[model samples]
Target: MALRSVKFMTRPFQHNSNRSIEIFLGTMNEGNYLNVGLGGSTQTIHPDDAKRLRDELIKLYPLALAPAAAPASKFKAGDKVTYKAIVGYGARGMDGRKGVIKDVLANEWYMVNFTGGPFDNLIKVHSDYLAAQPVEPRGFKVGDKVRRTTGQSKGVVMTVVETHPTQARGDIRVDGMTGWRMQKYFELVTDDPVEAVKAAIPTVNSGRYLVVALEGANYVPGSKPKVHVTDIGANAEAERLAKEVGGTFHVFKATFEASREKPVIPPVKTTKL
Candidate 1:
């Protein structure tokens, strides 16, 4: 297996325009996202699209452009979203797109979904690129996951609205919607392996001894470890702790380095084998 490192992608650069694209791979979320940068503007997109675009864009020229920063918003999930970007000399070219909010991503970028049809070009976008739209309850198919926007149901796995098969869909206003909310928070997740690290133990000098509180006289379950000190005070503290926890006390003499030290258990050499 190959060791994984932080991977970054430069979205097919077109030096012809003043814009460039750069992205970083991150799992700072349950879902893997790309830290997408459009020239000075930044946002995030899915990792799969990032890889797909990377392979296709490599043949393009490198655009040496510095990324500009932008802030994410307090916008809730499932909101109607509109944004525009100078996609830089691509087939779609510079244009504005409309879609639904997917998820609240790190660094303020939101995952945008244009999953169907002509608007599907956009994946993620910064708030600066986003245009505001009114919040309204809309009709959606059953078995579709939706997010709660307000009230006690906020952020909870919501009990979605009941819709009739003939229920027409759009931004149309509906009456008597006692407990319904509009949809648009991203709810998908992707898993990645986490790296584990060991904790480092501190060292004590030669004259010191490491003290530990034992659960039993024979160390069946080592209760706790106390300070590694040279003074009798450490032994006293260990004894008191052991007693309080219904355990026993034990100590190890310090070696040239306490880290290399072992217990002072002794045996009488009355006979040699």
Candidate 2:
């Protein structure tokens, strides 16, 4: 009797998205006449069986196809945004995840604090994966009691010290709180309020510097009088100390002459008495 052999070929489906695809192949024997053993190498698959395998494989092609979605944007350090996962790539209940803006990284991505967890586990999402959430003000006045939304001692407003744009350092009192008795610190609040204050603050000139003026001394001619410095901080410490101890402290300007510069020479007498 002659033996029949067959070969099967399969191709994977391709999609427009940047994702991986896989293909699988299988064979079966129909004729029991040829006592086919597992190691005999005479495995045969009927033509109908091959067509059924191709159809089953095609059913899985849709699973490999990813939906068309936008790419993530380049996020910055302080941008408030939200996100939603692309279908077939995210959890069933986590279609739309909301979180506070925290950090941004290279490859056009940023982080959002969805579960209030450590930075490492925070969602590192692409720009197109997130949407900006509308920030609603917490109904607390400048002096109203409000705690830090996030940080070491979260939710303990202690006191509402001040609110400013970009940064808001609140003086929080944590004397009675458990595990936070000694944690007296400030909260750095960011967002629109702080940003507004920052914008309103005047810009200071960087080139200008502060200078201390020297004290001037009073002196009388001929008499050895104690000199007093009217202005104190302007001169050196030793000069100030000397003036305090009855020594004259003189103010020297480029064009000004010192009172002690000229010594008194008595007039010479030529006539004999």
Candidate 3:
């Protein structure tokens, strides 16, 4: 006996101004079948002659396929924006204040000059922190992976959720936590935790790196892990101290000019996690 296999295909048809239909066509055991779906209803039919009907359906609902437009930024430099204070986050002490965009920085960051705020000049902030109207932090959305910037949950990674319908009133929801949270309290993290962990741990032979053993295990995941540059050298002392205190150490390559600091060395590839 020969083995039986199924072949599947799909096509979309416009039904009305606001509705569309999708048809899933398939063949099994020398027979033709169609699974038609629209909105929430789905119907299947096994017809003796499906090809002719399929072609007729395509002609009945003229294909409306077109290219989608690209998304554009809502704000630009010199644009006026306003947002409520996020308490512990940036723009603190400036509740319901208006500001002007001094400059647009890279990676969705902006420098804003708020009226009668904490700083006298422009301050750098994320795009989610500012808006056209007086609103809570709109930086986070559903399914975003983020880390808290304050309180006990600081540094702990979590995902954003829309548990409640009133999410626009500064009630950002996240997994494993209750109550309404604000978007200003959390920042997006790298999608891959392992890569983030590895990038944070500096390589031993990266040259002129600062080493400091942290007070907790798995330095990246700890709450407010603090470590000063104890020494500025790439050596085995970091590994030794990490094992001795049952904690972890990180390396940082610093660049200095006179009393001012410059850009540090970038993270290098390493076999060690």
Leading candidate by TM-score: 3
Clashing pairs in 3: none
lDDT of 1 by residue, 160-221 (tens): 34654443432211232353333443221113233111112222343666665455445542
User: What does candidate 3's lDDT look like per residue over 1-273, in tens digits?
Assistant: 343434333343455555444434333443545554444466666665456666797899878889787455667888888765565775446666788988877677888887765556567878777777545444666888888878998778898886356654455788878977877778777758897887467544333455655555543523543334444343455676677866667765556646657889999978976
Worst 10 residues of 3 by lDDT: 1-10
> Regarding lDDT, does 1 or 2 come out ahead?
1
Could you tally the backbone clashes for each prediction? Answer: 7, 14, 0
Q: What is the TM-score of each candidate against the true structure?
A: 0.21, 0.22, 0.25
Strongest candidate by lDDT: 3
The global Cα lDDT (0 to 1) of model 3 is 0.65
In terms of lDDT, the poorest run of 10 residues in model 1 is 194-203
Q: Which is the better candidate, 1 or 3, if ranked by TM-score?
A: 3
Span of 10 residues, lowest total lDDT, candidate 2: 205-214
For each candidate in the order shown, give its overall lDDT on alpha carbons: 0.54, 0.48, 0.65
TM-score of 3: 0.25
